[model samples]
Target: METRYDFVIVGSGVSGGYLAGLLVKSGAKCLLLEAGKSLNPKSFPLSPMDLHTQSSWGGGVEFSRQGNLSLYRAKCLGGGSVVSQALVDRVDNEILEDWAEITEVEAFKPSNFSNYYDTVEAVLRPYEIPRDAWNRNAEIYLKGFEREEYYWKPVKRAAHDCQDSAKSSDCIVCLGGCPRDSKYNSLTRSILPAIQAGLEVQSEVEVQTFQEKQDHVEISARDKNGALTHYQTHHLVLAAGSFGTTEILLRSGLKKYLPALGTNVSCHPQFVSFGMFEEIVDAHRMAFSAVTSNDSKLRRLGVKMDSIGIDPVFVSMLLPGARKSLLKNLAHYRNLASISVSLRDESNGNLSLDRSGRLQFDKPTAPKDRHRIQQGLNLSRNFLLAAGAKSLLPKTQIFGLYLAGGCSLGTDLKTSVVSPQFKLHGSQRVSVTDASLFPSAPGTYPSLTIMATTQLAYEHLRKPV
Candidate 1:
């Protein structure tokens, strides 16, 4: 006999972990499933190479079918929260307004989401890094912004007691995992608390498919050792991220009922530009990201620029030269300053499974999105030049860290997978509350907004229809 849980939440990332905590605190029996293994601070990867290979899906280097961009998604117990820098920024009001109009969900507006943001902030306690603690790489970014006369501001991160010092490069290791436990992640902030509240967790279980019955939902998954496992749930929450959630639904043949199951996917394509300076920048030391572009025009154009610290392995991939030239450029790693430009793409793509039941996607950078990237690149080049960079190494390889949409939220079943009420359209026992619910690109760092939106979805779930 299978013990049926009140809620079986898949993917113990930001959405799943937070939702599990809330549901369990409300006295609901919940089971949280994660595709990756649970790792503690001591077990976190020690090097960038190990981090990318172990903590991310496809070894952090899967490219699109069109070969236009590389896709990186976290596949660990805490999902992206474990590997990210913990930068938390809310979506702009303009983006939220567009979402409200597109989904016809008034709760997406700033006024409604403010309280949820407050709730998340109270828990995460995000704070801005002090200017004095800025690293040499950050100093270069500040110089460029000041020389270019572009608006910039300190970035807010969900970190505490980072113990960041002028000589400390501890922050760089955080890209793999924060060993000091200073960074707020799902494992520390949500999943562990939910466990204390009686939430059951199953890590290293790759969910394959689910079927919604009249009364309960049946789930089929495979454990790490290749044994099939079954689970029953009164309510199913698909928080397996955009790609994971869409793949599961497509594999389950649910697309016959929901045409938009894997449509309207948007990834904020990011391009990194490196500037070689005469002085040693050591950008990877101290805080990796300390400031972001606050230019109003750039925001209106759906472009964002931020200082970035890249490990040597990733920097080699981004460097333009090859062979001897690449090695020569890499030798000056300490003198390279980096900045990333991310565009809120207007063009949308879709996800589908191949003949072998493998997940594949076609996400081409649309002409408009290309234009935006180019515009951002032009500005970034100027910033680097104005900051006294001797040479610039701009790579054309595009990648996306922030993945959203696929199972969008709206009022109509013809175009949306999830209803505004957070329930899957045409399914009684299933719901979705993750980045999969994004109707379009939010044009911002979405970590803060993702958590806030999950809070809103939780409110709807707690109420009876």
Candidate 2:
């Protein structure tokens, strides 16, 4: 086992991938330990149906369970960037101000953070949806919002030459993985650069715990064959998303000392609403989540409405509970256009390990949060009706997509896990630079914001402690 390195990062997701690249460029010996196997960019899924098939490198999904709330996330090298729709939005000014105040960190100020944001944007190369790529489903919302005089705009997405994905009839599989290598996932865009720069990566390694001393930290991980290996590094960074990082700390007994380790988890819980129109609407041929509402009224309520892409498999799952009408809903899938209304929930939850060491989510949508969801649903119905829909079916099932804030940053150690600089409380060499450091849930797409946070952490990582 490699016993010495300048830095060891857990999880090769957005933060870990980008940080590894930066560190390697600066001549640091870095090793990235990823739980999932590395995927080849050349073999990205060709069609939506290709997602379920096993590739040379394996990709899988894990679910966060509570009672009725189940959150699905990617368990792979590229993490959420691979499985997401690639909707890239920066942190809202309001969210930034909130972070600055909560953590008392000047870096969160919009002016100071602009440099990091610009750096991330340059790398991501996000762009608005082109006119030719606007499929019928996306257009439905655009036309409806225009008619209703509601604020709406084209969504910015991170991708390079996505024309093929946008033109394909089976493009709805984007949420699973982009086979064309158009989407700017970390594996192809960031981690590969780091690999070329001499950064070491070990896939299929599950880190179990960390033994931190004054000068170095030792990590114990189980490899694919269940063989445990101990690796040592001067610096340890955790970028394993919110739940994964929190679970690690909990398992390592950090939660006993820092009670805030697994609390204040927030998610953008969304409900999907379907509108059936007489005209045939092939929603899958466009970029998923092509446009969203920007109305101030909705923003105050922490609600955002965006167009959604649904393939046959997902559509079948969301079919009405009535068994008799299941086939009827399936038959109209082609003619139905869908929109998702997601709310930035105010009520935060907690993450805890079950008796078997499995991570469990205990966040329930608060009544106030549910009210905002209803507000979003009502607005969605109005927009769908404006699009000349013959009928509307709004599913009230709440599902969370963008997860954040399990190990949040704050000035108060009693309520937060990390400091404003992304350093874990009571530790010098340990830091976190992921969505888990978000002070609270930002009320929009958080992919870009999460990346930007790592940029901030990178700046601090260069300074001597």
In model 2, pairs of residues that clash are 44-179, 45-179
Model 1: ten consecutive residues of lowest lDDT? 163-172
TM-score of each: 0.98, 0.94
Candidate 1 residues 270-341, lDDT tens each? 988888999999888888899999999888888899998888888876666788988888889899998999
Candidate 2 C-alpha error for residue 359, in Å:
0.9
Clash count, one per candidate: 0, 2
Question: What is the C-alpha local distance difference test score of each model?
Answer: 0.87, 0.80
What is candidate 2's CA lDDT for residue 362?
88
Task: For model 1, give the RMSD to the true fold.
Answer: 1.2
Q: Top model by lDDT, which number?
A: 1
Candidate 2 Cα misplacement greater than 4 A, ranges: 45-66, 164-167, 320-323, 394-396
